[model samples]
Target: MGSNPAAPIEVHDLTVAYRKKPVLWDIDFELPEGRLIGLVGPNGAGKSTLIKAIMGLMPLLSGYVRVYGQPLEDRRELVGYVPQRESVDWDFPVDALDVVTMGRYGRMGLFTRPSKEDYEIAMACLDKVGMADYAKRQISQLSGGQQQRVFLARALTQDASIYLMDEPFAGVDAATEKAIIELLKELKSKQKTVLVVHHDLNTAEEYFDWLMLLNMRLVKFGETRDVFTQENLRMTYGGKLHLLSEAAEKVARQ
Candidate 1:
């Protein structure tokens, strides 16, 4: 589909490379506002790379990205990001509450301390992710799921209009997954846009209202029911889709 000026995220001809080897090629798509979007593909398909590109963390070899029809730098405050759990330095010497408090830095004046309200907001966000009890615990001391929950709390503290999350569900327990999906739905209800880099084919259809299939390039971008087809799966995954196809079929049947 053509770009939507009113879309939460509009990426056009985006290309990213490392050491002159392309990781993402000519990616172009506009994400609808206030919807749950899934970015799915095989390993090395550059799903995480795409998220970083939109967040302006990665240098683009070509094209551009816009948030709410404005340059990312102009609307940076409106976007929140949650990097993959694996990418975080969990061993950092900081408590869960301290980590969540950092999310407010974007809104705070430089060199200024967090106000009481900021701390209250951070605590509330931690509570929302079921980690208020562990707010004072060192991040390195928490379990994998707990660490992820703390990061989610950090993102919530931003209270941005759009959120770009990288595999928030990876390696989490079922309870954490349930909690995360519930929180994502709540964000949607509040008319906030969320984009997640996801790997679970089994739960993708159930989790996202929109899907963007990619394999270093755009395969399809549309409603989940329209884009999550066997043909598109084959095109996106090729020989890697045999088992994933069976799982997708099961989800469809359900």
Candidate 2:
């Protein structure tokens, strides 16, 4: 809905499903440019599926997704994806820098070796995530938070304009979460767009500017404060949680 010159990621009448069971339906929304938008919902809510469909990782049952006014594949270098921690095997034999270099593979094309410039870019990404010191360490040695940061660094090395993250906070520690938030805010400041799949309701208000509530059926999506109210929360979370949160907020204010 924003009229900004920088085009945002737009999903129009988007629908996605698995085995003919509809997971998302008639989902229409515009993720404004330069904001940290959180996609919140319970398990099986299709939060991850939403990002996957946008990124072209999954087939769309219907509708269309556009990034910065162009389709996803057309701007491959402009889209970065940080999948769930469980998405990859931890025992893989790769160092932090080694992992970051993969981000440049798209620009370098397939089966080609990384040039010196690629290594420089990867190191810069490591520095961005505060993992420059751990560049030599194997990924398996990292804590959950550190591992997520490494993945973030990988995405950053790609210099993408749009970021789609699936539950980046799931297993990370509080400290790491804070660090990641700081990094994301920096990205927003640079006019890059970030959409995260999140679950912690307590911190949802503080973490995002826009909120998309999904229950495998496109419950809601809009400005965070507007859509995260008690009425919408009930529809998104449940009636009991709405009552509890309302009471808690009233008590805190009193």
lDDT of 1 by residue, 1-254 (tens): 56568788899999999999999999988888889999999889999999999999999999999988999999989999999999878888999999999999999988899999999999999999889999999999998888889989999999999999999988898788988998999999999999999988878888999999999999999999999888898888865676667756764565
Question: In model 2, which runs have C-alpha deviations exceeding 4 angstroms?
Answer: 2-6, 238-254
lDDT of 2 by residue, 15-80 (tens): 888998999888887887788999987667789999989989889988988777788778778989
RMSD of 2: 3.6
TM-score of 2: 0.91
Go through the candidates in order and give each one's C-alpha lDDT.
Answer: 0.91, 0.85
Model 1 spans > 4 angstroms off: 239-254
The deviation in Å at residue 168 for candidate 1 is 0.5
* Clashes per candidate, residues 3 or more apart or on different chains: 0, 0
